[model samples]
Target: MDIKKITLFGRKDVKVYSDRPKNIQSILSNHLENLKDKEAIVTEEKTLTYLELDYYSSSIAAYLQKKCDVKKGDRIATIIGNRYHFPLLVFACAKLGAIMVPMNVKLSAEEMEYIINHSKIKVLVSEEKFISKVEDIRRRSTHVIPEEKNVFVIDGKNTFNKLIEPDYPLDSVTVDELDPAYILYTSGTTGRPKGAVITHINVIHSLINYQKIFQTHEDLKTLIAVPMFHVTGLVAQLLHLIYVGGTVYSMERYQNKKYIEYILKYKINFLFNVPTIFIMMSTEEEFKNSHFDFVKKVAFGGSPIYQQTFQMLKESFPNAELHNAYGATETTSPATLMPIKYPKSKVNSVGKPVPVADIKVVKENGEECRVNEIGELFIKGPMVIKEYWNNPEANEKNFTDGYWHSGDIGFMDEDGFVYVRDRKKDMINRGGEKIFSIEVEDVLKSHELITEAAVIGVPDEIYGERVKAFVVGRKLSESSIQKIKEHCQRHLAKYKIPEFFEVVDQLPRNASGKILKNKLKEIGRK
Candidate 1:
């Protein structure tokens, strides 16, 4: 199919097939039977067909319903890696109307405890690799203890060996479009993680947005390279592919060369990743020389894309399209997306809002700002979440007049493309992972030896950026750095861990005693 000629969105003649069912779960189940013999997911050596995915997901959902008492509206947390089973569990949970929460596997025990407790999660299904970590925190916190007696392990011995029979009559439950499908936790820039309650309509809205942005066709084969824990990974990539009956190449880990090899090997059309992944791929000589004949579009987000890097990508993938999408976990992935064709013209813009979503630049006083005026981005539509999970205080402060207050600083041009200036709050994007500096600093300050601490992001080549901690300590040394990190490892995720530590006599502060993080960034640059 000639992708360049495809300008408009949605299917003009979308003959809603007999196989395409009404509900999202039934959509997967129906498609699985329709694509029973067709290849659905491709790994390095294994290709799990639609039939296999259907069987496993059905079995898991059935097991959850019968054994684990995971009825409709119950919240289940998944702390597994990016594997086939992860999506399977996600789909299963969605099918039963259970809210699926995907935990950041790199998070420490204390961090996990905060989310588990805050969300009031029931049962947790994790990989064998992280069994010890999960078990260690299970007894420590009573936040989201399950009423279910048995905690069914994902890749463990008990009940994991059971194969789902196709003959088992699956009772399809009626699900409201507004019902919560998944609760993705955003990195709490101010405090603990806030669970963003994404509904079925929100997911559908996002997929429709993807269809509009990417111009999805029946032949589109997207690669699921991003972690399923993220909304982009689930709604933009996986669910979008399933909705269109397109193939998805799932990977457990993203080794740059190996991902490139798979792109060439399987002839993937759509590739989604962060700026870091694209930067690495662009620098590889082998990748520059390789023929990406079938690869049409490359979508990127989770961090800003530098102009230099964007120009390099244009020079490298001359034939391919690069899309710059912008959204929060609250907006069900992306409310705005830039066209792949006009990279140079729309340099720093995050494109325009998708068809169903409404975007506006608003001042601190809740009034809308004009074009090129920097203000907070406000979004209102089916895609936007109703509220933060169980946090009325946050909802009162963040959301107003039916628009989600995206804590990002950006403005729309005359053409309606958004240019992200900086984060309104101090939310750091180190590599693709989001690390709130304040969150990290709070953890570091918990140490008795540290009098004061401030965290800042410094420029990095591999991870896009790295975190640096500036401290005012009574006893600070190289050894103290390790101690601070060990302390942080207890409360924060691994990516949130500071890569560099600087012990200073006194932290640069304002007259009001506010630590000047900008000064720390400048000092770190030296």
Candidate 2:
């Protein structure tokens, strides 16, 4: 591997992977011819070999091309869950140079409609469970009307099966490396979600970054334990493994017992998920007894890990390398990954920037922060998405000089390791004294009585905002709250201690396993 400078998105001297596949279609084409009959996807219902994946995806592509007139630059949307069809649609659109839009299945009809119309989708792929929502979208709006033929429903009448019957055949369509491949929407917890346009070049570089860090092999096997719509599942689990010519077992929905069973049944070696999922898996009955050392890699992100879950992972996978990868939909998947050979003292840090990634911390005055100084983190690389789809104002505000403002309050240590403290909006201001919620939450989680904790800023007349913490614990008494405050007082500064503590069963989370701070703020107001 060589480091070379190339021009990209009007940015000269951009570092990129020296030698790689031209496009995602080319990457799979190499495997399609060589790894034919090799298992590509194994679902609960069936398994698909590489050759079958190619033929079926090609058949669907041909149908869309010949019947729906879907050509290069077209947008095809999937409102389905984790299935072999999602992967099929990924390849089919890649080969045709059309964009695949994966929507959150849990979204309401109105939310789904916003994405569908905003992306100007030409075809919509969904399942029976969500067909009513799709129909509702059709009934409510006049933005885009999909033809009866263009709507490919997977469950009701087996439209996907008939479309992939091998009768429809397609010729190769010319696709460039930088052509858009997918439009993934952000989790709009506070506002409307924006579609991030990802190109083949961005995806290829991200896959290579994972390869560089994890040293991925062709024989590695992984399971999609998270939502296929999110970055962790879509980019990290599905696409990365596909790029390595590895096997992907589709888990339609995440269940703790099922995750353990698949780990044993499939001999799954690679794992990637959000920290919350791992936290729950630590409590599963099988998790304690089944000390299977087969899993070779375990990676997590989307939230900070508590002490218990981190220790359980270390004890369970003694032979595996654990990583805390941090990235957003805009950065493909991982902008930073915990290096395998890192100091145990810096476990809280999220490791250095990926080889191609450039990260900087800037203050409100637009000046770079010194080592160990907190500021907003900005990431720029070929892996970063060029812009938000059809949102010029968002593009202007979020991107600058090819860098995407991450909106994370963090600091890079003198050793180059990056530590994310909190989201800028989530930082509490107590009478002009800045308070990072993680500081208080970290101390609260360290208590033996608490299992999980989330901190937020509450409105107060005296101080603009006050610190509030929501913790999950067993039978929290009145005295328990006082003891928790005493524990925080010992470890945290006076202003950093939470002013209020509320015990709850669990914190609110999005489909991707990220804590919904906005939801927590609503709870604080009430």
Instruction: Give the winner by TM-score.
Output: 2
- Superposing all C-alpha atoms, what RMSD in Å does each candidate have to the true structure? 11.6, 1.3
**TM-score of each prediction:** 0.76, 0.98
lDDT of 2 by residue, 227-299 (tens): 8888788889888888889999988888999998889988999988888888787777888888768889999
Model 1 local distance difference test score: 0.72
Q: What's the true lDDT of residue 362 in model 1? A: 93
CA lDDT, every model vs. true structure: 0.72, 0.87
lDDT of 1 by residue, 304-357 (tens): 665555776667666778888888788888888886456367877888877666
The backbone clash count of each candidate, in order, is 0, 0
